[model samples]
Target: MGHLSTHVLDTTAGRPAAGVAIELRRLGADGSSEPVASTVTNADGRTDGPLLEGASLQAGTYELLFHVGAYFARTGAGPEQPFLDVVPVRFGVTDPAARYHVPLVVTPWSYSTYRGS
Candidate 1:
């Protein structure tokens, strides 16, 4: 079975970004979006379970909206006006049978992500 997972790491603090809000959305062909899942990161900065798995996982474009601004505000880790607000990591899922691990390594000024095993 395939699955989709994510985690947030605060590069500034050098720790997992716990309590970050994440929204998973499936992109439509016409540019519309459909909400797939929404959850907050646990203490380990990971979802309790795969956001999407098994039959729900599909081959298409998806977006993970990481609410970094709110997270920063709550943690008092970022500036009053954040340079990087709600960070959106958008990518394609080509194989439904493969595991998709998209992680966000972020700071108040920047963020990075990649396909992981």
Candidate 2:
């Protein structure tokens, strides 16, 4: 019954980071990374479906890669030299029966994330 989800908010613009590209990757047993799913943020800056569905949810280390640089550039929020290029948030899933919500609040110069409901 484990589930994974995420949301992104552009704090500088006071709105959701719409159209942002996100990649969900799982850490393989061989210490390499594998893509689990890829998605784009909706107008609400959230995935329309569960990031990890069905048997994909497991107890392990995973990464959420946020393409902040491209988002900023497309939105014209920052110049060519953006503060954050690719933001990678890594965390552990200790329980396969639990639901994980990783929410990211980001700006041109900074970003933060936390476990959400």
Candidate 3:
């Protein structure tokens, strides 16, 4: 079976970004996006459940919205104006039978992500 997952790490803190808000969206063919699920990161910076799995997994574009601003604030990263607010990482799932682990490494001003096991 296929599955979708994510993890967020606060580069500034050098640890998992716990309690951050996350939204999973499936992009429609007409260019509109629909919400797949919404959950917050656990202590390990991962969702408590698979965002998508099995029959729910499809071949298309997906978007992950990470509310990093609130996370930064909660972690005591108080900047006058956060350079990076919400981070959106969009990627495609070409194979429904593959496990997509989109991990995020983020700071107040920057973020990066890639396909993982």
Winning candidate number (TM-score): 1
> CA shift at 108, candidate 3, in angstroms?
0.3
Best candidate according to lDDT: 1
Query: 27-92, model 3: which lDDT tens digit per residue?
Result: 988999999999999999988988999989999999999999888987788486777888999999
RMSD of each: 0.6, 1.1, 0.9
**For residues 50-116, could you state the per-residue lDDT of candidate 1 as single tens digits?**
9999989999999999999999988898999877889999999999999999999999989999998
Q: Across residues 1-117, which tens digit of lDDT does each residue of candidate 2 receive?
A: 779999999998999999999999999779999899899999999989889845778899999999999999999997689889889999998887889999889988999999997
| Candidate 3's TM-score | 0.95
- Sorted by TM-score (best first), the order is 1, 3, 2
What lDDT is obtained when candidate 1 is compared to the true structure?
Answer: 0.95
**Deviation in Å, model 3, residue 93 alpha carbon:** 0.8
Worst 10 residues of 2 by lDDT: 49-58
Q: Would you estimate the TM-scores of all the predictions?
A: 0.98, 0.95, 0.95
Count backbone clashes in candidate 2: 0
Evaluation by TM-score, superior candidate among 2 and 3? 3
